[model samples]
Target: MASQNRPLSPHLQVYKPQLTSVMSIMHRATGIALAVGTLLLVFWLIAAATGERTFGDIQAFNASLIGKLLLFGWSFALFYHLCNGIRHLFWDAGKGFGLEAAYRNGRLVVVASIALTVLSWVWGYASMGAL
Candidate 1:
């Protein structure tokens, strides 16, 4: 008979999404974000190496509200990717593979990323005499 009595293994919708899953996906997404954001970093470095006018222009753009917002997002993404990367390294070393461990580590990464981002921005603003 060609009738199916049961579904096959590894069905895509079998498992519902969770915070840990969402964080994992976001981690990867932020990785791409940071990679793309690096174009500006490269430009900044090159401009610095070139001349004051070029560097001043770069700084001006980066100091604008929209530019600050973009860089803020970039900073968050960078920290998120970094924290998640460290978590992955633990996995690579055969740690935090259990479900409970995975969940905890995922939370740790997200929290640590947010904390780091806030700290960085705080320091940046302080240096700018804004705080």
Candidate 2:
């Protein structure tokens, strides 16, 4: 009897990351981030219902630098998830199946998400007179 070495499957280290794969991974990640961000939304709502003091405390925290950063990240994740989800809808409709179209739409999703996120933040700050 004899044992033989066998070839193993290619993995992260063996293969370079591609745009499609990276976008797919990011879609799942942003989905999870949105779910977590929803919890913060619920907390804020509850604080509002509880009392002015509690709501004010929440507002104060949200006005802080760290809180602002988290909100910014959550907003970006929301936009990214939304744009990627729309891309998935097109895929489900049997569109953008070609490699070139897939690549083009993938870039479109990234650009649109970033643009929307920036625009929303700018609008928010402007409305609040913080800009």
Candidate 3:
């Protein structure tokens, strides 16, 4: 039989998602994505060291539509993680703990991440003469 005097734990179904909670979850997810994306970096480096044929093959694949999409996703994850990490540093310094402050900072992180990602891709393409 359930105890009538004990307090019940809050269930996720009954909780309304807030920006702080959503950002916390996203921070964890982006961290994992960054780790997986590092493998692609390692592969590119190994291909370059092996020989021209191997490097060329990797380049060709990376230039494809799907590969571009993956690259964009990786870049976005990188920027998001970077921005959120900065927010964490502010928290470590004992700041921005207010509810409104947290929400505002969360929004800033999202905007900064998107802006940084777009700027990075634009610069990359421009340097490659694609822009």
Best by lDDT: 3
Residue lDDT tens for model 2, 71-125: 9999999999999999999999999979999999999999999999999999999
lDDT for model 2, please.
Answer: 0.93
Runs in model 3 deviating more than 4 A are 1-10
Model 3: per-residue lDDT, tens digit, 38-120?
99999999999999999999999889999999999999999999999999999999999799999999999999999999999
lDDT by residue (tens digit), candidate 1, 1-131: 55576767766486798887778788879988988998999999999999999999999999999999999999999998888889989999999999999988888888899999999999998998998
TM-score, candidate 1, is 0.86
Between the candidate structures 2 and 3, which one is better when assessed by TM-score? 2
Model 1: residues with Cα > 4 Å off, grouped in runs: 1-15
Q: For model 1, state the Cα shift of residue 47 in Å.
A: 0.8
In model 2, which range of ten residues has the least summed lDDT? 1-10
Ranking by TM-score: 2, 3, 1
TM-score of every model? 0.86, 0.90, 0.89
